[model samples]
Target: MFDWPLLRGPVPSVVVILGAVSCIYLLAARGRRGWWSRTVPIVVMIGVIVSVIADKVIDHVLYSASVPVEVLAWIGFGAGAIALGVARAWRATWWQRGVVVVTVLVVVAMAANSVNRYYGEFPTFRAALGLPAAGEVAFKSVSAVVEQPQLPVSGRALDQDWTPTVRPPAKGVVTQVYIPGKVSRFTVTRRAYIYLPPAYSDPRRPLLPVLVLLHGIPGSPSDWLTAGGLAATMDRFAAAHRGLAPVVVMPDATGSLLGDPMCMDSRLGNSASYLAVDVPMWIRRHLQVDDDSRRWAIAGLSYGGTCAWQLALRRPATYPTFIDLSGEVEPSLATRAQTIRVAFNGNAAAYTRATPLHMLAAAPHPSVAGIIGLGRADTTFGPQQRLVYAACRHAGIDVRLLVLPGAHTWQVWSVGLRRSLPWLAYRLGITAP
Candidate 1:
């Protein structure tokens, strides 16, 4: 049951077919007082209104991101179907009501499964239930496993001095650790997940490079672990390179699952400071990795992508390389005015100082290099990404823009991560460029 695929295969299709048949049966079944004739139209109208309101609420007040029209259609269809079921059951027999209830449930499942397939958020039953992936362990256990003498490597690439051997383990290990906001003093308690490559266990322990991953808003560090397929992706790369992969660190940028820090030191949260200062500091102190700032890179999807772009431009010395997957034009909350009012206390000047476009245009960042990834069908963010790419190019920043297939969903993000791994590896000194 845990392995039941939610996104693809015959399950979703069969559920959809059942839901369609149920809808037809519910509408066609004879009833008193011309119920189907009067109620169906009213329910459809109400569903349309509700869907419009929901789309507006999500875009304007909640996430500030647009929901695809297809998903909105499903929302309306579900609403109408459920209302029809209830209305019909009002004058039906006991068994008929029972059948209505089952029909309603199937309709709900169909809508839910359709939405899930659209976003690819929960690809399996296990993920939908919020369980950790296989081979994940507590942080305390990792400490004992990595208690080795300090054996630091040079500032050069790992491929420069290291050779692959059959001695190293075939797979890496993932651990969940609580990374306190020590320097930023940002009081948000969230555990981080770390992926140590197989080469990390070498007796002659070479200090590997680090890659800090950030997840989108409405997400936790585990999004990268599950939806983004971080560990599996990194493990595959490691296998190809003879167990040589950067130490991937996934720390919480947003304090909570629904929190949007905007990756700034604002009244809402000291998210920028926590990510740029405390996260890197913690990585160096706790993990046996290279201390060279140039050896580090930052990458993320959506909100995390925007944050990565912000940090890389703001602190080029710390993160000279970055990957932005389906990021917005800038880090914002609904609108520029609202973001300024909420985050900067309505200080437009202060907001300007924090905006990435302003910073990029202010000076030439010749040292900063990054990749801007966009989904081919992402109508909303595709334009935003092109605008950002132009800004980066004009500012003399070494940047590459990639347009992959899919919309603003996990499909695009996961593919973006996998596609960018080779370039990331080269940039972080894991392999040759």
Candidate 2:
């Protein structure tokens, strides 16, 4: 039951149905008194109003990123709030109070299920509990397997003669490690996750390419491993090519869980420096991987996707190749003026110069290549992505845009990453170009 899938199958449907039934009972169970009936309606109305106002505040004022939470989630929230009110206020029989308690639980579950369905972030109950999935271990324990090899003079791809001397692990291993913000001095402490492909288990420890995966706002590094299916995808890719896949590193771009650094160097945080400099330096020193900038690729979904664009543009030599999934054209916070005020500390000139369009128009990038993926139903970011695609072309970037199904959800992102793997593998030199 712990690993039971939460997003799909009959589980969510059953929960929704239960919530509906509970709501109906709560609505019909008002006492025979006229005042009780009037009071029940009043409380329910208040609950609905409160939920709507809160949603507006979160979506319109607090966050610039359009959250994927649907109206169904707000309905559930209202119902749960009403149930709690009834349980506390109604002077009723013990059975009625017990029913209200059950209703509260069911409605809360419904709201969570509805929200989770939108993002598809937590697919299983185990993941919802924030537990590491199977085959995950602490980083310190896996250090023995990582061997330091002689740094190459020129960039090198996987050698044709390289073969596993020992039986490689069937799947890659995921490890959680704290990458210190030594240079950037990023204060918020968060651990980065590493994915060592099956090839890394070999005694020779073939130095593989690295792919840095970034997560969206209101998320953590674990988002990629859990909803993004990092390990399983890499394992399948490696199995097809004699245990060869890039070592994927998922780092914390934002200092806090909900903090929006906008992937820039300013008052919010030195997220740009952390990602561009600190992360690369950490990868080189701690992990036995290729140092060639050409072999490194960066990818992200939404906020992370926007950051990927910024990194590739700001430091082309470091991340020449990138995959952006449903990212905004530019970093934002409610409004352009507010974004500049918060992220750049009222430095509108710096903010304007930092946007993707501004950076692309200012300079040409002939060596950079990128893949832009957007959902067919995503009317919001789809146009933004199209604009970015045009700008990239004008700036001499080798870029492709893919319109997949689903809107600003993990459905698009997971598939986008999977579809881009063949091209990514070829570009990263995991497979022959």
Candidate 3:
């Protein structure tokens, strides 16, 4: 089960509580004034507080559980009812009424957007608010799952050359296994999913490369299976290549930031250690993979993008290649230094040191290869990629940057991943047959 308390932190809870209290006080005091003058502000405030809190709570719960779209929609209906009631009861002039109506609509729209962020389908009210349709909801939903803290470290290595337990069957076979980890125990076991490639089935193919595929914030391992269609994608590629596919591993990247792990080791959790060490160690012991640093690739979208860079830079001996799609590089220490304090355990210097852009400047890793893809329309794409590209160039590291057309949507990341695969394979020496 997902943790609801994780979503509504003290910050949001305090804000909601204060809003509610203020609304009640204003409404009660307004009774002394004219009905129209006092009732309007009082009812509007009450409506705003109720609608916002109810919607936020529902969104928090729905996102945590990966609940269905219909369930979120039902919650939206209840929230909308409260909003409508307040709007109707607000005794105000035409302009005031318009303002209240607009505010209510905006709140409803935000709630709908939150639901779409988790449920993989936009509610009807989203279209009414001029929001994007629900084509990429699955990716968003899966991202949420991968970011959840249900999975944590297992203190195992993922570089074993071959293990019967995690290997694929010879010819036509598929198996599923669950191994619990130390950090979150049962929660981690239930959420972690590992996939061994076809090469694992053949004894001739020893030391197969591994690709630690990460999902963005609010995403999970299931997103690659459902939204990314990675299994089918790998199957087709492998078939065409005469049976060569990289072992793909996906893990939840959320736990600290936004109830989603920023993929960093923080006060919220030990996600960084879980991904960089535990996941790889587990795969090594259970699967047939090349344990060497040169054969490993780490990549992710959004916050996962940030994680990919952080992991590769920090553990260059473990991951030599990194793919970042529309990820934000942590800002320089001089600016937003406090962010590191908040996100990385109150250690600004450590945060700056761990940042890929900064680390590459001090000590260059020759074996490491990097690819950064950014959407032209994404607000952070160009600037973020520029920082990464500049750092790689300064370090004389091999890197590629591609700017494509699109927004911060999964469609862009999916297309980017597909396009980058051949290059990545070539760099890793993963040829057909």
Candidate 4:
């Protein structure tokens, strides 16, 4: 049951790879004769049983993740059919290898339905063969390719009947950037991504809003661009609205590619400061956007979603609207003691003081709006999200809790973004409130 969702995204790749391997095995098995025919069936049956046991052991004792067995089960089922076909071909004088091909194709065709349901149509099919996808744009560095836009103290205003400096906008241009860490002074570290909608260069461009999109703990800024389909989604919105979209700054909050950062200014790094101060400061200095807090939103998923809530409450004046897509209730480790030990160097009081739930309790309730979007099947985070939503309502803050269809996977996140982006646009004044 747990493995059913995993099959949705990975089955197509499995089919392609499994089908290829089956073709090769079909040729090899065709040359076999008498005694070997019977042994092949016995061997395949044994192999299937052994593999299942091994997978269970690895899932329970070795790996940390709850490894799904559905995909592997499909592979075994296909392999078993091929093995039976091989046995039959060798037994008869007229060795027809078509049986193996038919069985493999049938199994694969059934699995193909689940593709793009989770990973969101990866850029290339070659990736199914375990090859690096070509045309992979690492990060779009806008500052290096184009000159930085400098806004006056007032800000960039709308142009009457203004046309875009760069016209015929398709999807937004994603450029990798090195946003200066002038305030936090954290490493200029990993590259961040900036998305310029078609309307950015438009002469009639209104003061565009800004959304700081954050990824999960064990993830990169590129996760949003690649797996989350940020480019495609934004492009659709931009194409509809004549290139008018938020100046999307996908800043790297987690300094390391795989570290949690917890959105805290701790021994790990000044990640909270980086997001709240450095990234925003750099965006204002370098990009043309509405400088108003009302026009700014900080949004994230998983770890980044937790960061969004933390940043919103801590710097309520800077970002009043935060979209938490499947975020935790507070900054967490395996245990409270462990969190205190690691983050604040054994200072339990500091850990409690810095937690988002604690901070939200102490802070004054300002007129703010929040979106708590969680996947309906995601049991771990959904309950906590409800608590946070309730807290927001009790505090006189406006909040909407949406339980979308999907588990904790890209399928859910894609929906989360699709739902949140319009609201984000509406709040930031890109669309009418």
Candidate 5:
């Protein structure tokens, strides 16, 4: 769950809160002329307090559980105000009645915004409306494919190459897989999906590179397929290259669909092990892939995007290239203290040690490759990403930053992926330099 400051920043939250308070004060002062009017602001003040407390509790619970029960608390506030309103409406003066209604509405609106955390499985306001629904995105299971070979093998050849038995149409095939975490043992409960390019179907194509992708919190791996438009984007790239594109594998970073593990091996779940260890092991065991660090990349958006940096920075031997789309500067459970309490057993020093920014700052010029992209209007995360990008650049890491349109919405993330493909292809060794 997000605080008012997280959604709209500190200044906006302060202004709105003050505005509500001022309106209530004036509403109460006007009641000095009327007997029943005196009780109007009193009831309203009580209702607003109830709403505020309810807001905090609901946000904390929903952040852990990801349920839609916060609406119930909002409904309770509304009903309480209505009941008090009806009890006084008969004897209250006209102005008093009007003030009560307006006060209740303001309280209710503020309460709703305060507990505004869940946006279903899609992106925020603008992107949710513009992007395709989750069900509209499609994927099929892997079937017969012809193994092939090509120029410039990625590493020492051992396993046979892979390709689809038949040529893929415009849109490539996405296969659903339930990769068990036999090694990492980090709760292999959630099933994941993979995208094979058109070239995978060719019997004469070279062994292709791989991209291990992930999605945001309160979301499944399907978000990339449905809203991010990655499959279609890669398919288009493949069509132009005679069916040659990187194999895209989207794994479940969060153990439960709505749960956030901060992509770390914490009490929430062994999520870091799940992604950095189990996911790659499963991919190599199940599919024909380029296991080299240069050929394998990991990336995500928002929560998953931050996790991408964690995996790349912590486990650089496996994944050296990464893409972070609108990710937080570091792992966030809202505030620094709360994040420390939850993720690091209240040990602030331990958290600082694991922080991506700190790790990047302390590194002795690691040869890490990254692409950071976010919306220009996303005040909350835009500035943070810029700071991280600068840190990475100064630390001698090869990193690029992109400022796109769409404020913290899927518009920026989707376009970021589309624009970064050529760069990703080159880094992953899918395209010729």
Candidate 6:
């Protein structure tokens, strides 16, 4: 069943306004006769209440099911319900007629506002709805880029339909594995996609090292498969460098509000356990992977980059190579004393304990290797890379910082991954042909 509660912010507003207006018009037409008028309003209100409750229950149930099927089923249910409701209220009284007209006008106005949101051209009506100003601005900025139109050009279709030719993985297999986390009771279960290298089928070869890939805030494992194009790049690299390719595991890391957990054990949930414990366990149990720390690496973009450092620092025994692609490290004690104290319940020491910088104060793990990449134009993350580089240098850890050309977007990360893969493969004892 569709979980209406899972619908985005605008969807609920649309449903509530339309549903309430429909109920009001129905009552007005029925003339409030006998207890019918009073009873109908109460019943309609009750129905609304019941629908919300049912939505939550359904959401919980669906989340536990297979992820792909659950998404499709929920969408289908939501569409059917909306259609039924609209059809039932199509014919109505004078007040109902007036409501229909007003609703149409309101929808028109909202559509205009959506256009503005798409262009980043105007302030959204969300402020009128009482959303925070900063949230509104962020929402507008993100939405504008997402909603922008792409030119109708494809690799193979210049004169035909404007369909982009998406190249499939040459010899990789993409499989979704669900690992139940403690937070799954309240939120979506953690999802991980394992991408096997081209040589995975070869029986005589040693198992390839695994690179745990993480996505940024508001993104899922599918982001790498769809946007990052890691599989295609890895395929090409493998073909060039013998038959060896590193297995990549993309896991959802946004178990907390900060999106990327920085791979720390969060007080809000067991996100760190989900990533560090559950994910590795799942990989080892299900796939043919190298068991040694020297064969395991971790890399991520943006928030994932932050997580890469945290995971490596916290559990150096598990991951040997850490790749930070334009990622910022949590501020050091001297730099973030006040901010840490405020953010972590006035516990500066606790903050330091949880931070990657603090963990690196001890001698670097001999098994662990670190690579930091940043774009020159990415002023925000460049300095962060430098900080991590400096700390690793001071600790006498084997770390390399590469300043590439680009900004904070996927373009930089994609290029960084291509460059970093060869080094990672070499360290992991995988020979490129």
**lDDT values, one for every candidate:** 0.86, 0.82, 0.58, 0.69, 0.69, 0.59
Kindly list the per-residue Cα lDDT of model 6 for residues 237-278, writing each as its tens digit: 766654457778887777633343335554444566676777
Model 3 has an lDDT value of 0.58
Least well predicted 10-residue stretch by lDDT in candidate 4: 152-161
**RMSD in order of candidates:** 1.9, 2.6, 13.0, 7.1, 9.1, 16.2
- Cα lDDT tens digits, model 5, 215-328, are 886677767876676777888888766677888888877777667778777666678887888778877766766656667888888787789878888888878989998888
| Model 1, C-alpha of 39: deviation from truth (Å) | 1.3
lDDT of 1 at 56: 98
Give candidate 5's TM-score.
Answer: 0.69
Task: List where candidate 5 sits over 4 angstroms from the true fold.
Answer: 1-147, 151-168
- On lDDT, the candidate that comes out on top is 1
Clashing pairs in 6: 241-432, 241-433, 242-432, 242-433
| RMSD after Cα superposition, model 4 | 7.1
Model 2, 1-433: lDDT tens per residue?
Answer: 8678899998998999998886676666544565455655666666676667666776777665444446544653666456554655467778767767877778777877888888788988878898887888778766764444433334344645467777878898999888888899886568889999988777777778889999997789989888877888889988888888999999988977888888888888788899999999989887888778898999999999999988999999999999999899999887888888888889899999988888898988887999999999887888998888888987889999989999988899999999999999888876665
Query: TM-score for each prediction?
Result: 0.95, 0.92, 0.60, 0.72, 0.69, 0.58
Superpose all Cα atoms of candidate 1 onto the true structure and report the RMSD in Å to 1 decimal.
Answer: 1.9
The number of clashing residue pairs in model 2 is 0
> Which candidate number maximizes TM-score?
1
* Number of residue pairs clashing in candidate 4, backbone atoms closer than 3 angstroms, sequence gap of 3 or more or interchain: 9
Write out the backbone clash pairs for model 1. none
Which 10 consecutive positions of candidate 2 have the poorest summed lDDT? 148-157
User: Better model by lDDT, 3 or 5?
Assistant: 5
Better model by lDDT: candidate 1 vs candidate 6: 1
